[model samples]
Target chain A: MSDSIPDVKKVGALLLEIGGLLMSSGASSERIRITTNRIAEAFGYSCDLLITHRALMISVNSNNSNEFFSSLKRTSPHGVNFTVVSGISKMSWKIVEENWSIELIKEEMARLKSISAYPRWLTLVLVGLAGSAFCFLFGGAGLEMAVTFTATVAGLYVRQESHKLKFNPYLNVFFGSVTASMISGLLSKFDWGTNPETAFATSVLFLIPGVPLINSFTDLMDGNIMNGVIRGFNGLMIALAIALGMLVSLMIYQM
Target chain B: MEDAVLILEKGFWFAAAAIGFAALFNVPRRVLWVVGLLGALGGITKTLLITQHQSVIVASLAGSILIGILSVIAAHGKHAPPLIFSIPAVIPMVPGAYMYRMMLGFINLTATLNSENYAQLLYDTLHNALNAVFILMALALGVSAPMLVTRKESVKNLKLKRN
Candidate 1:
């Protein structure tokens, strides 16, 4: 597995970059550890990779080499991007199997990065449908579901726009939740459907802490207790933000 | 027959929701349908169990176990981690209503001036919140069970390969 010992600095940088990309894309710490290690081992080197909430570090040494290559990358706060994680997962294997040169791997990663999951309009449509699905599942009939579909489409648009503007994510959830809930509240107030109560609730389901909650538990199960606590705390804060928006809407409706 | 149809509808919508969220999360296009199917499976199982009068904890745990097993199989087939599927697949079962109800209950408990109803509201809030918490915990544990087991097996295989 040994060729001209790959340039340590270049390999270390790539490993850290992979770590940053995976973590920022919301891949869990454990997966980041295993994936980066595999990629390193495949490149005819051995490394220690540590992935945490704020940063990822990789250090590599060849048994016969005196100097070590190490790099640390800070992870950005990110929403889940499963496509990137899966792409890197698959690409790492391909690199091993094909014995891809570093330049080839770099070119592939850039190509993968350019592939958006869906166009903006499609994302909006699908998220709107998701909101409608939740409404229907919770007992909304056709009218309420339609209202939610529209409300959610608009709400998600606001969320996306705010995110692009670099608004804090929790604040985006708060504002987005309030706007969606208020409109749905108006629909329910007028007796628009068989289950008005459900319409009011499900529109905000889009903002629920589904991933963070599950990630926290999984992190804890994997003995990453600090990460578990961090994720759990972050999720609780988002939940509180959601609750705040809903409660505020409730107050407005009462008034 | 009507019951089966209603259950079928629930499953369909849950899968639809899964696809929606999966898209939002940017799941790899190649495997999106499998994730949707897994979500449907979990949703139908939970809905059926609830119809049978199973407690929320039991229903959620059972549902997530199905998701867990399916994700492990999918994890292997897809050559990716199980969480990539399980996370979005579990979204349809999130206790959003309970969370809202708990918050609403808190509002009432706080706004009231220590009246008899305040005690009731406090209890109600705590009860609903606890249900949300417990069901959530059940889901996480259930989904992780299969992943952890398979992960251990995979690790063993890797070590064997090294030798």
Candidate 2:
């Protein structure tokens, strides 16, 4: 281990980088605070972090001296990537155990950032299958599951395309639901399945904002009420967007 | 015997759904199967409890707590955090049907404020909304309780050992 402490400014920047990554990647507030603090402690410094929906502020103080540094970094828009969250957790442990230098930490962070998501086609198809599973679990028969599979795939495609076009996240959800429900609403119109309503309902199950809802509750439980409320409100807004989309489709089908 | 078979089938679909969502969330490939297993366990537990005539809220709570405990244990073996497994696993239990009904009734209520069935619509909407909210809270609290109890001490120990 290096006898001298790392420069406080660099450490503060690194800590802010870690905090921003975790915050944007759907981590609970507690996890962000803990993971960054763990990395800072490993470098013989103490970290205090103030996390909000829009930005992260971190202060790092050297244990050996009066040196201190603090900085703020604006987080990017939120997204879900469990791989990044877990990767950083593992990296923090390695930093403490292997005594990773800041350079090595930077390299590992770059590697993590570059990790590719699953292929777009694969994700869409599998998510479609998941929607079918939900339909079946909800008592939909084979034909209903098949219809749900189609609707979910189409809806997710629209969501992905809109997301790529830099549309608002909630707008993307609204578009996805509109597409999915419109497709399934046709099943009800044609009277093809034993329970067409089940298919219609479960088809949009793919867009339920599961991460934010779960994370909001965890944040609240950990006493981070401000972040918890923000996340909860975010989840509720996405859900409302979904409902409005479904309502439009329902009106079209006149159901 | 038939009931057991039905539960197994439900569990299978639940596992499949969980794995698909896990992939969408970009869960690490190494632990995808673990997520599937945890999902199946939670779903089967809820199904079994419901068969025994338990309320949906209680059953959901039991299932999510099981997932939470198992995820903590699984994290040790896989070298990943519990949330990666628990979040995707608990997702299959979301009260989608209730939420859908609530939203549908809400829309109808707004459109028919003076209709004869307005009171019925209002009651149904409130009922479904409350059920959905409670079940969601149960799932979240159950999955997070174990981690909240264990994480602080674990991190503290790591820091102490190093110092």
Candidate 3:
């Protein structure tokens, strides 16, 4: 019976290690929050920690917190591997184990992983396009504006997500505006099948509220001032981009 | 008469499209209808408010402030996305089409022989564009006023948190 107990313990530890690896690999901002929250609640512990490379490092400020440490040990396995990344040691498995749990932590993390899913980007695109189409129909634009506005905004939104770039707030605003200006200018020069107003509206649709103006306002209202300022700057850049595009088109017309 | 109605209908649908787009994006549905009404009203009233010989800036300011006041009441009531719900209504007042018209008119008049007579038309166009810009700025300021005032204390509070 004594011999069998050690073997059972080893196997259980192995399973927990593998699960932690999988959860950390899929970490997103929301998942990270839930994972950390679960760990704190499960162990009756509260600590500030960062998870990196599929491992968690928790900071505890009490001497008798060793009991809490053992709980983490049961939850986390892989025996607390440590590395000097982010100019901080004691920030990986070593901090968790030499300090906290291995098993319970893993179980809570698995829950977070189960709940995590990517946002549905396509649904947002269809919604925006539908709005643009409606605008084209009612606003004094011909068929040309509705079709183009829908296509452009949808395409921009889709392409942006696919790239997975650290979204530069100003770039999209400027680019969307410039692109709209170009299309509008081309349509105006040709005096095409539809009126100029339709063409202008269609091109500018993509440049609209996708910039998060209202959300920024809400953030400000909620007293998240920095976030509000950041989003506001982003919105301003977008408007400037539109103005730049208009300026360029004006210059071209003058020439 | 029929032509005018058709134009109005098209404008109505365009406004509806914007409202529909807002809905699809999960903007509060109650607010969307109000935004549509405000947009259409802004468009129609703007045309009526334009007198042949008037101060363009004054006209735009009055219109923008008027719309801004209405938007705040509606937005606060619905607890909707303020700028998203209000900005579109201002779209109908955007001077894009009018500015284009002015530029085109300038080009056509200049290209024609009666250059001196075309000055009045060119001046009118410039006035309209300037008025549009002024109005747009006012609209932006006015619509954002409620949020800005509410945010001041919150912003100050955030500074304390960051430190």
Q: Identify the candidate with maximal TM-score.
A: 2
Residue by residue across A1-255, what tens digits does model 2's lDDT show?
577677899989988998898888888898899899889999999999999987998888888899999788999998898888999999999999999989999999888887856888888888998999999989999999999999999999999899999999999999999999999999998888799899999999999999999999988888899999999999999999899889899899898
Question: Which prediction has more favorable TM-score, 1 or 3?
Answer: 1
| Cα deviation of B36, candidate 2, in Å | 0.5
Worst 10 residues of 3 chain B by lDDT: B153-162
- Candidate 2 docks at the CAPRI level of medium
Q: Which is superior by DockQ, 1 or 3?
A: 1
For candidate 1, the per-residue lDDT at A157 reads 85
Q: After superposition, how far is residue B40 of candidate 3 from its true place, in Å?
A: 2.3
Q: After TM-score superposition, what is the CA distance of residue B2 in candidate 1 from its true location, in Å?
A: 0.9
RMSD of 2: 2.5
Clashing pairs in 2: none
Candidate 3 C-alpha lDDT tens digits along A56-141: 44443222344322112222321111110100111223323343354543454344334312234543444445445544543535
DockQ for every model, please: 0.72, 0.75, 0.10
Highest lDDT: which candidate? Answer: 2
lDDT by residue (B1-163, candidate 2, tens digit) is 9988999999999998998899889998889899999999999999999989999999999999999988877877777888999999999999999999998887787777688888888888999999999999999999997867766534334232224
Q: Arrange candidates by lDDT, highest first: which order?
A: 2, 1, 3
Residue A62 lDDT in model 2? 88
> How close is every model to the real structure, measured as TM-score?
0.94, 0.96, 0.46
DockQ of 3: 0.10
